[model samples]
Target: MKKINLKTTIIILSLIIISILFINNLRINKADNLSKAIVLKTNNSNVISSGVTNIGHQILTVKVLEGGHTDSKLKASNHFTGTAEIDNYYQEGDEILISIKEKQGKVTAVKAVDLYRQHWELLLFGLFVLILILYAGYTGLRALFSFVASVYIIWNILIPGLLAGQNPLLLSSFVLVLLTGIIIFSIAGFTRKGLAALAGTLSGLFITIVITIVFGNNMGLRGMTAPFSQTLLFSGHIDLNMKHIFYASIIIGASGAAMDIAMDIAASMEEIKLKKPDIEMKELIQSGFNVGRAVIGTMTTTLLLAYSGGYLTLLMLFVSKNTSLRRIINFKMVSAEILRTLTGSIGLVLVAPITALFAGWIYCSDFFIITWLKDLKSHLKFLRP
Candidate 1:
């Protein structure tokens, strides 16, 4: 086995420690008044009152698993009906989530929130981590760390900032920059290739932002078209500009594909340079273009399919309703999807050439200089001849 580099070991260890601390702190600081309970018995025939629609109750026998009632050995249960059933229908032996209302350390009321499936969800995530590490080794570890960091930043910073009425465009742009730097540098390492990729990605992101800002409004897109956006406003974020959020989402969404193209081209160019140090600048640039061509072909379709895939049901609904093509195209949801896909694809298209240029300049600079001197020498010799 190859010996691990000391620097790499230290970096990985530090990142692991930081991740652990961050996750722990997040859990500790999470302001939620909830507890877990396991259902022992369920009775649906309990009628405490009569109503117009024959309102009944479900008395559930449960045992508290954690939180404020953890110390109580006696079993407990809560009666729920009506709107609570819309949240969940419980069964015996099922784990549930609950919140209790207490007065002077005595429980006044208990509400069953929903079913608990976090254990299986966490297990699935563990499997994903294991598969990633096994498949990609050190690179997978770096990718996982970046993923965690991205999630943490979004949850802790971006969400809170947006809720606090910060400018979504500016905040999202700053986040994109941070994510771009972290993802590229972490995956590619702090090398010339990484820098070239970062530069290319940022350039592509700039183009995406400009294009989105200029055309997104004309496309008649609003953040409210996004799922839960209206709910966000209704839930006390009235100060948020749904339009600006929509535009910012476009840029941020496109940035991932742009980064992919940039890294591909930059890495290709770096490899070509290392393999053929005597290659001319023009040849290196051409090689980068070739690499970009191959990447963008699939990547463009990837963005389109990804954006449209989620709206398959909506498309089917329109088709069933016999919606006209023109109307469908101009529909708010459809238009928003079109704008997102096109803008992201456009940014991805630009990433190739930008990355090619940056990589050629960074990786082939020495050879370019040498090629220039040789051309000058040949020109002088031709003049003499």
Candidate 2:
């Protein structure tokens, strides 16, 4: 067993302490109602004009008249006209400020000075990163860097390109290839292993893109099936072709699995070479195939599980409604997911053999073409001379 070095121990301890401190600071600075403000405005008209009001709820109505001098003064009104419960302590024309909460463009809650919810996800995220650094060490740091790069590329390049009316299928395909290169090479470094992974990942991703485009169109998977897609239309900001987005998403989502399979096969081949440098071409290729067979089974299932998990609630709703299998499967989102997951799985299967053949030919001694040609020439020249 390798002994723990002093540097590693200190780094681990420092990471733990930093994680605790950051978490504690996040808890201390959480939301409080003291930061809120309540204001009131008055309309002096004797005729009380009421907007839409629902029973069993309270409303705070503020009237701002045109060309009113009160705008500069931040006016507070003591006069309000509304029905209140008998037990509610308020005099007629008394100064009172009411709080209103709007949900989906309608008032839902009327409470005073409620504390805004503090989102703790960022703090939890920090702790998660710290934990990863402390435990996994160098590998964790590389994974983190890759994750950040993925986010940056997606947000800065892919999204902007989509919004600019670039062809979704083409842009997404290009982005996926770029991301695969960055992610695999950054994690694995520049080596034969990295090259093998890059080749496998690119081949698989291309296959996935082709499959998604063909099947997604045939299945009539509309992009509007995704949540908030209609909202983007209503907002008047996005003039997008929805079906193209659906096709793009299929390819983009599948690229992750492609990269995983490629990396796994490449890494396994690298390990094999390190262990048995003298392994022949046939055996080395077989070794890669063997490892790929084991990986593909789980990886295919992983794609299914990941894609299906998002729609479990929708599936349950369909089941409860006694929807027929034909109808359920015909749903746009369901069909899209099926195409995405299955197409990506197919890509993974193809990538394994493709990578194995290339890696074997490149790394194995017996199959090296240049070396073989050189030796053949040397033997033939003696006979000729």
Error in Å for residue 317 of model 1: 1.4
In model 1, state the lDDT of residue 366.
51
- lDDT (tens digit, per residue) of candidate 1 on 25-129: 777875656788888777766544444322455677778899868744333444444543244566888898877778898887777777898899989989999
Residue by residue across 136-219, what tens digits does model 2's lDDT show? Answer: 776676566566667767866898798888988888878887888777755765556776788877877777777777887777
Estimated TM-score for each candidate? 0.85, 0.66
Which residue pairs collide, candidate 2? none
- All-Cα superposition RMSD per candidate: 8.2, 13.2
- Off-target runs (Cα >4 Å) in candidate 1 are 1-4, 45-59, 71-86, 366-385
Candidate No. with top TM-score: 1
